[model samples]
Target: MKTYFRLLSFAKPIEKFAIPYVILTLLAVVFNTLQLALLAPLLTTLFASGSANATILTKPAGWADVTGYLNYFSQQISFTYGPFGALKFVCGVIVIAVILGNVFRYFAQRIMEDFRIHTLLNLRKSVFNNVMDQHVGYFSNQRKGDIIAKIASDVGAVQFSVTGTLQVVFKEPLQLTAYVFMLFSISFKLTIFALLVIPISAFVISKIVKRLKEQATMAQHMFGLMISYLDEALSGIKIIKSFNATEAIKDKFDSENVRYSDLGRKMARRQQLSGPVSESLSVAMVTTIVLYGGSLILNHQSDLTGPEFVTYIALFSRIMQPAKALTNSFSGIHTGLAAGERVLELIDQKPEITDAPDAVSITSFNHSIRLENLSFSYPGRTVLKDINLTIPKGKTIALVGPSGGGKSTLMDLIPRFTEVESGRVTIDGTDVRKLKMESLWSLIGVVNQESMLFNDTIFNNIAFGLPDATQEQVEHAARIANAHDFILQTEHGYQSNIGDRGMKLSGGQKQRICIARAVLKNPPIMMLDEATSALDTESEKLVQEALNNLMKNRTSLVIAHRLSTIQSADMIVVLEDGQINEQGTHLELLQRNGLYKRLIDMQTFND
Candidate 1:
């Protein structure tokens, strides 16, 4: 119950609708109770041997106190006849009350539905926006499917908690309470005996609910894992087929599927038990009440007559249905609370990086970029140490080194993807940490070895970074990157939709499209990290040409694994074991006969 209340707090923003919804719910509860309670009068009159058309004043014996109150309200509001008016009046009141109940219920449900969808939509947007603001390293450690599950499945669970649980919580309890109160008014001693079973049944239900909640939480987590497995397997289908690991992957998936199914079945079994257990207990209590109340009528110790006893029994039976429903709803609330906890866990996570209060935007770059004795470590090991370098404005600097020599880490530092432990990175004259992240990133463009494209049209992909770019500007940028020719040859040309991650296009084509996107941005600085390493010789030539065109006048920082690519670089910085080992032009480094010369010789030998 505490967990449910906590989950409900997430809907606080939609609290303005709560009052109206509660009012309508109360009205529905009243009318629904009246509809059931109306049966008592018709039964009483027919059983009492009075004229079927007896009026309210002429037949005080037939009219229960509650029924008389209802009759008075109905006659005051509308038409009323004399002795035979009660029947018509009761029937008419029931019809109008039912209509009003349903109408209020309809509007109340609409308000709740809208509020639930709106609140969940806002929560999803907030989670996505927070993820986008995080440093790149945050995603590097996360699975794509897991993140997607958090956004889609987990957030959806919260919506169910808000809307579905709210319906049961508000409606069922009000109905149950109204019925119980009516029972109390008719026969207090009998109602007391009937009420005794409630707490005992509730205690048993509570024990089952504790276990059910634990299983439900486990089931949702397993579902997430299953989704992630399917996502991973589908994304790597080509690789799996090439490796002939289909059966193995299938076996793994089947195992996970079985576990997920078994857990779900267990949860279902627990939930299924709740309904029957509640119903069975309710039947026992109703039977006991009939026997006990029948004895009272026979002994003439109660004020009620034969017809009144029958009416009371009929009204008391109505309580069981709603009582049963309340128990079922309680179980649902428990499961929903478990699901909401998962979603709120993600929403509560604090991002590793964010804009500072004093952060300001930098509109232009006038000075050089400086790395002052920078040092960085990951987890337990240092990756960069005492690395000092100066990148002058309007000049190109290339980082060339063996794998794991911290060349990529050096480029990562410029963007503060991983914070430095002992030094600072300054862009122009201001520390990058002091500048607003948006302004810092706005000035830089990065082109990685693998191009990332969404499932959208070619034009949209090229214009991704610059959303407001005109068609002509996109086309011109595509032309500059050598992507225009192939795009035009496609079925819809630039308007053609690319498949997921641009999987429909060849590697070279995707790379060219990525280059066009970077070209469209036209940032002041560029980071080319092994940008042509994945291409074949011919594609490499084309991409390298496009890259050269893009980097012509920009302050470019290139990290290259292939020695040939950086042969004509203006300056090359050689890194080995987290520190600079050599710095010179290609020919100048080769003349030094050191680490750079050794690397060139090794490449020459491989060729």
Candidate 2:
């Protein structure tokens, strides 16, 4: 119930739709019930057509006597005009009642439809916004497909099943009450006998769908798992094919599919059972009511005339329609609530990293960035330990080391992408934690080994996060990164679509484009992680030149694998097993014949 209510809170200002829907639905129910209640008088008029007797009827004493009022008015029409006129009048009234009832119901449904759409729009927006705000590490621990399922599939399930039930919850019960009142006015004894089915039907149906919520929760989880499998298969299609493991991947996916389908079949069986079970119970109760009521009428122990008795049975049977709807809604809410719980769980999640109350924004970089007493670790393994370093303004510092040496992790700390475990990273003089994240990120640009380009036009990719960047500005950045000429050779130049992750471009071209994006941002500080490591020799020369252009006269931190690239760096720091093993100018490190020299010698031998 807590999760259900939290999900519903997204439908704020609900009264805008609720107030009008209630008024309209109430009006619709009244006329709808009147249409059925008029059946008694219509029958009275029909049976009396052969007789010319104008019987004067007494008006009922109270307003609750709906059947009495209908009978009195109907017979009065018979008394004034012939029985044929009364028949015409009653039929016209029934037709008008139906038309008005239907009109109001149509408008009411229209309002509810608007509410459903409004709720869906707000709910989806909230879920997506919360997801976009999470820190980088949060995504590392989560499955992308599972998050996607929560935002897409679970939210959609909530929109239809949960919000749709709001209409049934309000309209069905009001309708049911109106039907019950009319039945009682017609014959209190038979109505009481019919009403007993409520508790009996509820109890029996409860037993049938007792495990629906548990099964529904499990089904939602399995669906998320299946989506994760599909995403993995699509992302690794190349590797799967290269390894000749296509059949293995397919069989793995098929196994999950089979389990989801089987669980769906089970849930369907339970959900579908409630409808027929309630309907059958209604039928049995109706049969028993008819037998008892007919006995009363035949034995002359009751005051109900033949037409009124028939009217009672008619109204009694219609009660099951709303009852059946309520039962079905009860079953559906379990499934909706299950999906709602998943979605709400996401919305309730707070990001581990957020700006402090007194965090200030820094508009410019000055002096240097310093790491004091720095140490960091993952779940069990330390990545960086007791490391201290300083990067002054307008100097290029390169970090070269073996794999798992924490070079990339060191760069991430500058932009506050990963929080420090024990040490402080300060920009100029203030702690990075005391700086606003947006302001901190705005001062740095990054280019990774694997170029991260969206499936968009080259110009759009280059100008991302800078929506106001002009074509002239974009072209200038591209030229500096050596991407301008190749971009012009493409089908539409800068307007040409770069396929998914820039797959349509060559290795060098994609890296150059990524460099161009960084050049466009023109941050004071830059982090280049193996920018040219994946390219061929000719491509490497071009990209290395472009990297040189991007890093000129800027505060730069670079992680280079090729020893040749960083020989001219102002400072080169060597890390091994989460500790700084050497730090000096490239020539100075080689003179010392330490780790840096060994690395350069290995690459020299390989070349």
Candidate 3:
């Protein structure tokens, strides 16, 4: 229930629409109840004989003063005609009431539908925006399928909850109240006998609803797991084929599928029982009424006429519709609460890194980047230990190390992707933490080993970081990275669309376009992480040339897997066991004969 209230808070942005939507729903309920109660008197008047002297009707005691006003107005209209005129007027009033009820219902339904879609759209956008804003570490622990499920299926469930619950929450209670009041007016004692079953039925339905909520929560979890398994299988199709492990993956998917199917069936069965149980309880109540109310009419103890008694029975039976609706609505509320909890979980996650109070904007970079006694760790393992380093402006510092030796981790510190545990990283004399993240990050360009590209045109890919870049500027950047010639050779040149992750292009082509994108951004600081390590000799040569051009006259940090590539670096720092083992020029490190020398030897022997 608290989760639902939190979800309702999202409606605050559109309160104008929501307020009117609720008001119109209440209005529709009023008319619908009026139309149903009017049936009792219309039937009584219809059964009267042509010459029978009809008794002047007294105002119904069950309604408040507002209903009394309506009753008076209806009676005045009834008196406009002759003796049979009340019956004719009653028929016309019922027709108008139903028409008006439907009209209000139509607007209410439209408003609700709009509200659901608009709110859902905003929620989806918010989730996607949060996902985009999360750090790389956040994605490392999440499954693509689960994220997609949250946005698609889970969001749809919330929308259904909003719309479905609105109808029952407003309409059913009014209908039930109107029916109960009409029944009591006809014969108070019999209404009491029938009403005794309401609380008992409510209790039974509530008990089932508790179990239904548990099943719904389990079902949603199973749904997330199933989606994650499917995502894994599809993403690793190549690996499965290479290892001939299709059967193993299929079996795993089947296991999750079985769990999801079983949970779904259980949830559906629990929800399915609500309507039947409520209807049965209502049937029992009706039976009690017939037995008791029949005795009153038979013994002449009650003043209800034969036709009035019949109308009372009809009106009492109408309570079952609303009771059934209310019971079913509780089931929907349970499902919604479960989904709302999941959404709230995502919405409530605070980002690990954020701008601090009094953080100032950095408009320019000068002096140097200083790392003082930096230490960092993951959940259970330290990745960097008391790292001390300084990088001056306009110098290329190459980080050479074996795999898992904290080279990439060191670079990640520059952009504040990961925070240092026991040190301060100062950029141009100001601690990076004291500077706004957006301002600090805008000064750096990162070209990763895996070239990240979207399914868009070559021109758009180059201009991705610079949305306002002109066509001429895009071409100039491509030329600087040596990608312009190859791009022009393609059918559509700059307009040619790349497939997902740039799978349509060769490895070197992808890398060069990534460089082109970086060149277009023209940030002062550049971080290249094994940018040419994956390419063949020819492609590597071309990409290296482009990188050389981009790195010129920029403060650069390069993480290289192939040590030979960084032999000409202004400074090479070899990291081992999360600490710097050697630092010097290529020939100077050879003289020292330490970890850097062993790495060169290994690469030479492997080659």
Candidate whose TM-score is highest:
2
Q: What is the TM-score of each predicted model, taking all chains together?
A: 0.93, 0.98, 0.93
For every model shown, the clashing-pair count is 0, 0, 0
| Model 1 lDDT tens row, 1-607 | 6655655665666568788888888988888777766665545434433555534433235444675454344434333444245566667767887898888889889888877877677778877877777788888887767677778886787677545777776777788888877776577787787787678778877766667767768877877788888998998999999999999999998998999899888878888898888778777777887888888888887876564567577777777776666677667766666777776666677777776789999887777899999998888887889998998877789998888889888898787776678888999878888988888888899999879999999999999999999999999999889889999999999999989999989889999999999999998899999999999999899898999889988888999888898777788999998999999898899899999999888989998
**Candidate 3 lDDT (Cα, 0 to 1):** 0.83
Better of 2 and 3 by TM-score: 2
For candidate 2, list the clashing residue pairs, or say none.
Answer: none
Which ranges of candidate 1 are over 4 A from the true structure? 1-6, 48-64, 68-85
Clashing pairs in 3: none
* Best-fitting candidate, scored by lDDT: 2
Tell me the deviation in Å of residue 293 in model 2. 1.0
How does model 1 score by TM-score? 0.93
Q: At residue 334, what lDDT does model 3 achieve? A: 83
Model 3 spans with C-alpha error above 4 angstroms: 50-87
